[model samples]
Target: MGALETMMPPPKRARLNGVEIGYYEAGPREGVPIVLSHGFPELAFSWRHQIKALGDAGRWVIAPDQRGYGLSGKPGKVPDYDIDHLTGDMAALLDHLGVEKAVFCGHDWGGLVVWQMPLIHPGRVAGVIGLNTPFMPRGPSDPIAGMRARFGPDMYIVWFQNPDEPEAVLGADTTWTMDFFMRKPAAAPADPPPSASGSTFAFRDLLKMWDPSSDARERLLSPDELAVFADAFRDGGFFGPVSWYRNFTRNWERSATLPGRIDGIPCLMITAELDAVLPPSAAEHMPAFIGDLETKLVKGSGHWTQQEKPDEVNRLMLDWLDRRFPK
Candidate 1:
């Protein structure tokens, strides 16, 4: 339990854009506005700790479930789930709140959204913060291509983009998939079994073995915490969330035309050291994409930094926001 754990409180829900976007708001309504965006397979409740901390600090905090996940609007069309729609949903959410410009922060896929928001609607962003994901200068290369170039044959993104396969595999057993993704890594087997290559295991199985120790698993999440995620995914389904993976090329093509670099918008990037999905390598050369950038590494944490290490995450966020948009 880090500093954020003690300061956080539960969030409230809202109905926006023809869908119920669960969100939590704190701080003074008249204070500076900070909008927090959630990543795939995550709800606005993910930022529960930060909302209370930031709000108590006298800064207005807004955390939304985003359009496709949780109670937010989930459209049927694949094309409808494009980056334009995703970013547009954020803009509409801001408009709904009558906010002119807000400090934007996000993690994982949410980080991608915050990074692009400043580009798509530069006028509406006061500053930006990205967790896990990094700023890659847009070019002819797509996200899949970048993943392939970086991870080689065993690329998760490439596997995820395979249309219905992932949805079928993960959707069929949501709990199994959740357990797999949330689990920590394990130690190597003492005696390598015959005909047992680590590569032979399914991604889900391998992820389950990530933290073989029951103690680590217990510390990863409580039954109640796991239930929170399970309920959301069970209701939201995997199709809409997986659709985000299918939009790699679409996001790249759209981002290619924007200016090569961001100017004047202060930025902060917090990388989780133990996040299996998003390793430190992912953030390489991020400073090349933003004018003013600050980077921090949270040791002994996984992809769910906000949930796993709330206090540290909150402190870093508050420190950065205080510097960029002082009250």
Candidate 2:
């Protein structure tokens, strides 16, 4: 057994949505399963802690290194990573798991996909738990256009739109890219005001210009854990992952016909106190849109809320499952 699978279910793969999806799953198959989706530049390994904990609690849980990530197959084109394809991948995975609906729990970009599950494939989603990412209505303009106007082109999301640029930067040194991102926030992380470009995230105006050893930093992953991510990215490169961002405009354009608000379904929004990009304030209006909603804040955690504070995140998630979708 590899170091990554020491506690969680064994890694498995499936062909779904015309792409290869690598996943890990465990626990009873009797109830509505919990499907965990990962975010940008991440693998299913990111949920190493939650999968074991949640599975042990008697809930069927599946975590996938979604398309263009980890062991998953990467389609070459950009539009292939659109919101429909993302949500569809999960729905198809549910079909493979022989279940109809799942309580979707996602962190970072995974959260965005889970939030869209209700809109794109409403029948497949039993519930939602957003770790850091929030459920917001489709904006009046194309999201990429809004980001460009508000944060200029340097903003990471906007920066991702350019073909080959992000891929090159991130692929330059896979280990360094993973190392740069997988860090615990500085002891005294300053919630700096947004830059002149109007971007809310100043702490993470990263990639193009980052100091690997500037601050006395602590890594979120142990050397073995870090190897799992670095090695995967080293092979996969960033094209597939970055392509997800390239589809913002495409996703927004297609969302016009979909339901903007999440009604009926139970929801939980867990915000990280130190996550500048997806801060607690970002989730402020979620309750208004989600009629049945609950919220929690992970004190002192940064963007990597689940990995940083596994116990708290697990407690909150398991508690919600017990109340909202118990066995």
Candidate 3:
């Protein structure tokens, strides 16, 4: 087992905005603070490799469980997971830590939160970096409405709107869900039957096709590394994590005015060449929305860019940090 396999420390808790947040801290006491946030079905352990690298490089790093996952307080209401509340959690964390502002890095849904942070709590972020997900400007309509109209109700995000059904379906077997969701694109086969020509496809339905018997962690992570995630889900259940999806439209409505507006915040977006969920193409228009943006594509990786290709992700992030926020 590699060092990262055991890198995650026991979570330390801090009550922020009436919700208790669980987070792991590392690196030098006086180093620049960087808050790393994890996405759906992920905990701070998702940043284990990056934490080790950055900590070794003398940067202070904190990876949180966010609002609803891990040891953090899970506010059962879907409305509580909106972007403003999500971004507020980060700002509050900095306050709790006595940090004026910190570099923020996030993956997957966490990436979405970081992008919104600069807009929602601009003063609390020194810089922002995204993994796998990119900045998508708010459109003429609520994203959920457009997604439902285009892709229909079976779409993952749309399907997540109902609340209970998905929670039961995904939570029925947490271990299976974790193993299934963590499949790296390079290792897993595409859904056998392709989507109808020109019609939108349901991502959740496609996920149903994955072989539950095949544990992706075997190829992607050590048993210990995988356990960290599995244990968290087992304890927290899928409600809080899935609740993130339930707030798509609410988040869009909350951040509508900020999108497409130029922000001087230095941004680094890293895409995984093999990520189907947040494909590299999604970033094509980012330059128009972000004035200071740098993009990197990690070949041979999937949605779990930081975990699947840690070394590459860390190198790209640290290099960007040194250049953007030099010590």
Candidate 1: segments with Cα more than 4 A from true spot: 1-20, 145-154, 184-219
- The collision pairs in model 2 are none
lDDT of each: 0.73, 0.85, 0.80
Best by lDDT: 2
Query: If scored against the real structure, what TM-score would every candidate get?
Result: 0.84, 0.94, 0.91
> What is candidate 3's lDDT per residue for 60-118, written digit by digit as tens?
99999898888899997888988888989999999999998898998999998988888
Q: Is candidate 2 or candidate 3 better by lDDT?
A: 2
Clash pairs for candidate 1: 3-311, 4-310, 4-311, 27-55, 184-210, 184-211, 185-210, 185-211, 186-210
Candidate 1 local lDDT, 87-176, one digit each (tens): 777777778788888888998889888888888888888888888878767766677787656544334556667767766767665665
Candidate 2 per-residue lDDT, tens place, 253-300, comes to 999999979997899999999886688889998877898999999998
> What's model 2's lDDT at 214?
70
Candidates by TM-score, descending order = 2, 3, 1
Task: Name the TM-score of candidate 1.
Answer: 0.84
